[model samples]
Target: MFQDEARFGRMVRIRRCWAPKPARPMVGNGYEREFLYVYGAVSSLQGQFDWMITHIMNTTHMSEFLAQVSSAHRRDFIVMVVDGASSHKAHDLVVPENMRLLRLPPYSPELNPQEHVWDELREKEFPNRVFNDLESVRRQLEDGLPRLAANRASIRSLTAWPWIVSINLNAH
Candidate 1:
């Protein structure tokens, strides 16, 4: 599974949208600094996705998210591909017994399929929208994650690159 973390917040990014010619489109802007972190893992071959929303990004939270993913897939040994985040390499980080971390080379976000998941969420769930509060942002994430998870076909389509599907994890 490819793993990564994303920060979501009340800050809104104005995305391009279609507007009738000669009509000006109004986009709302948000500058609040409040933020939350989401930890996610996607299995491209199986189209299985796991995610957790957290108040902070730290070793403890990373460990907890690992545990959650481990619990969700008790029988499968997960070789999680992750980036070189400080929390990911913390000396005291608790990696679950059924999982192993494989670090991607520095400055290679494009290699992780999990990034496409974030792009999908931002494009679909948060396009041109401004949240009134942190809770509203959280609620949107809560809704989006499961909706994405339930659509196995969509998950596979978004993340299952040819190279990714070709690799053998030896899960048997």
Candidate 2:
């Protein structure tokens, strides 16, 4: 499984919008810097995942998210590929019994498939939009994640890299 966290907030980007050619251009709402962090993991082989949203991303939150993922897949061992965030390597990080973390090389976000999940979330679910508050953003995340999780084919298409597939095959 690949794991990562993405920060989404009221900072809206200008995305393509449709309007009459002679009319005024589309405008995005002003950026407000509030943020919510989403911690997520994807199992490419099974197209399954677990996620959590929190206000902060630190050792404590990381530990909590790990526990959630661990309990969800307690029957199987999980080799989680994650970025080298400080929180991931915190000295006191508590890894669940069923999972272990494998840090990707520094500056290699492309190697982690979970990064694509964040891109999809931002582009598709919350594009060019400003939330009224943190709670609204949280609600969108809550609704959006499950929709993503339920789309197994979409998840597989997004995350099933050939090298990852070969690695899994070799492992088995």
Give the winner by TM-score: 1
| Candidate 2: residue pairs that collide | none
Name the candidate that leads on lDDT. 1
Taking the tens digit of each residue's C-alpha lDDT, what string does model 1 give over 37-152? 99999999889999999999999999999999999999989899999999999999999999999999999999999999999999989988889999999999999999999998
lDDT of 2 by residue, 128-162 (tens): 78788989999999999999999989999999899
Worst 10 contiguous positions by lDDT, candidate 2: 163-172
Q: For residue 152, what is the lDDT in candidate 1? A: 89
lDDT of 2 at 60: 96
Model 2 scores a C-alpha lDDT of 0.89
lDDT of 1 at 96: 97
